[model samples]
Target: MDVVIAPDEQIGEIVADDIAALIAARPDAVLGLATGSSPLRIYDAVAERVARKQLSLARARGFMLDEYVGLPPGHPCRYSTVIDEDFVSRVDFAPGAVRGPDGDAADLTAACTDYEESIGEAGGVDLQILGIGTDGHIAFNEPGSSLASRTRVKTLTAQTRADNARFFGGDIDAVPRHCVTQGLGTIMDARRIVLVATGDAKAEAIAHLVEGPVSARWPATVLQHHRRVTVLVDDAAASRLELADYYRHAHAHRHLVS
Candidate 1:
């Protein structure tokens, strides 16, 4: 686990640097992308690189972390549409190169299974970019989600629905109550994970995910078990961490060791 505490705005370029390196090494690298405010900076940074011809995703593939159930096609809030508008359209990724679980499928169970297979057929994700929910959820794996679960449908917890209401005209009812998400087990298959968080709203969750014991109650805590995980946060988000200074010092001198 590598922890980087820095200004929230600067985090995007830092993460983009690693992503640029990965794309340089593997043109077809599978990238796991997350939606929501937390990861927008990263998407913007990567897109800037693509625009500047510093990097390109034309040959790469992408996978979304989750999707709301029953959103109509072309709905602005739909995860697929949002991903295209936010990242894919900005980059040079080939059409059809990115996919998400079929949230509108008649048989969501089968859709989940197929989504799992789709990821496997892609040789698994090389690097997964993530955002942590204020409640400590990751990819909609709310509290009590199984540590070894796979891609599946899950009910949106009250807190999650409320948090997402802002995206739906500030109406909690406008937010779907159900979603299909990659389970902790599925996310664990990624070769590497980069989680980003900011603001005091995420302080508690970030602290739990980094320093607390692994528990189903805090789904993001599962990352503690992952072999390659990088957690990036700003001062407000990292405020609750017990060893913030140590993490900062280590990051500062990382070049010496590298």
Candidate 2:
């Protein structure tokens, strides 16, 4: 794991530059997408690169990390629609280039299985972007999610629903109570992972994920076992990390040592 501490604005550019390099190396690289506020800055930076003709996602494919169950088709808050509005629409990805779990399938279990199979058939994700919840959840895998779990349906905890209420007009009741998400085990399979966190609100979760034990209580900690993972956090998010100085020095001199 490589921990990078930088200003919030610089983190996005750093992540975007890495993604652009990946696309340059493999035009068909499969990207795992994450929704919510954390990744929006990265998307904005990437979109700017695409607009400037410095990058292209025309042949790239994408997979969303999770989707809310029971949301009507085309719902703005739905992950599928949100991904389109936020990122895909800004790029040149072909029709059907991005896929998400079927939240409304008659048999959600089968949907989860098929979604997993689809990812495998696409050669798996080359890079996955993630955001940690205020409660330490990744995707919809709230606290207590199995570390080796695969794609499956999960009930949204009260805290998760409350946290997501802002997207549903601040009415917690309006938020979906269930979702289909890639499990910790599934996320671990990605060839590389990049998780971004910002602000003081995420400081504790970032600390636990970076320094705490690898337990199901904080699913993001599972990244500790991934061979290729990069955690990009702003100063506020890295505030609680005990080895802050070491991380900063390591990043600053990584080229010389590596």
Candidate 3:
């Protein structure tokens, strides 16, 4: 994993630079999109690039990380809707180019299977954007999720519901109790992964994800096993990392070696 400690305002540009480069090389690159506060800046940066005519997502495709189960059609909180409001609508992605697992399908198992097949048929994701939960969960794959799991429905942990309550007007009861999410195994197949975190609230999770031993209890730690992963964090989020100085030194010298 390549750890990048950048200022909160600048991390988005750093990640966007990489994505822009990828899109330049592969105009039809498939992207794994994550919703929530962590990736808003990335989307904003990408949108800015499109406005400047420096980038275009006209032929790109996207797969969302997860979708809340039982949300009514057109519900603002639905992951699909959220993705559209947050990122897709602001860019140039072709119509119907983004897809997510069906959270309200009559046969959820079949939906999960189909979603995984769709990703495989698209030649897999070129890059996946990720955000870690305060409890270390990734894409609703809470603690104890199978390390090699695939796309599937998962019960939302109480803490997860509570954390997401803010999006539902601070009412925990309003949040969905289940979701369909891409599994760790599915995320691992992406050619590259970019995980972002910020603020003091994420410090502990960042510490475990970067320095702690790989364990199911902290699902983000699984990134340690991926062949290509980039972790971007602000100073506040990197507070708990014990090897902070070393990470800084390594990042500073990486350009020299390359």
Candidate 1: which stretches are off by over 4 Å?
A: 255-258
User: Residues 1-258, candidate 3, lDDT per residue (tens digit)?
Assistant: 999999999999999999999999999999999999999999999999999999999999999999999886689999999999999999999999999889989999999999999999999999999999999999989999998999999999999999999999999999998999999999999999999999999999999999999999999999999999999999999999999999999998896534
Off by over 4 Å in 2: 256-258
Model 1: how far residue 219 lies from native, Å? 0.5
Which prediction has more favorable lDDT, 1 or 3? 1
Residue 255's lDDT within candidate 2 is 81
- Which regions of candidate 3 fall more than 4 Å away from where they truly are? 256-258
Please report, as a residue range, the 10-residue window in candidate 3 with the lowest summed lDDT.
249-258
Each model's TM-score, in the order given? Answer: 0.98, 0.98, 0.98
The predictions' CA RMSDs to the true structure, in order, are 0.9, 1.1, 0.9
Residue pairs in steric clash, candidate 2?
A: none
Worst 10 residues of 2 by lDDT: 249-258
Give the per-residue lDDT of model 1 (tens digit) for 109-137: 99999999999999999999999999999
**lDDT head-to-head 1 vs 2, winner:** 1
lDDT by residue for model 2 (1-258), tens: 999999999988999999998999999999999999999999999999999999999999999999999987899899999999999999889999999999999999999999999999999999999999988888889999999999999999998999899999999999998999999999999999999999999999999999999988888999999999999999999999999999999998898534
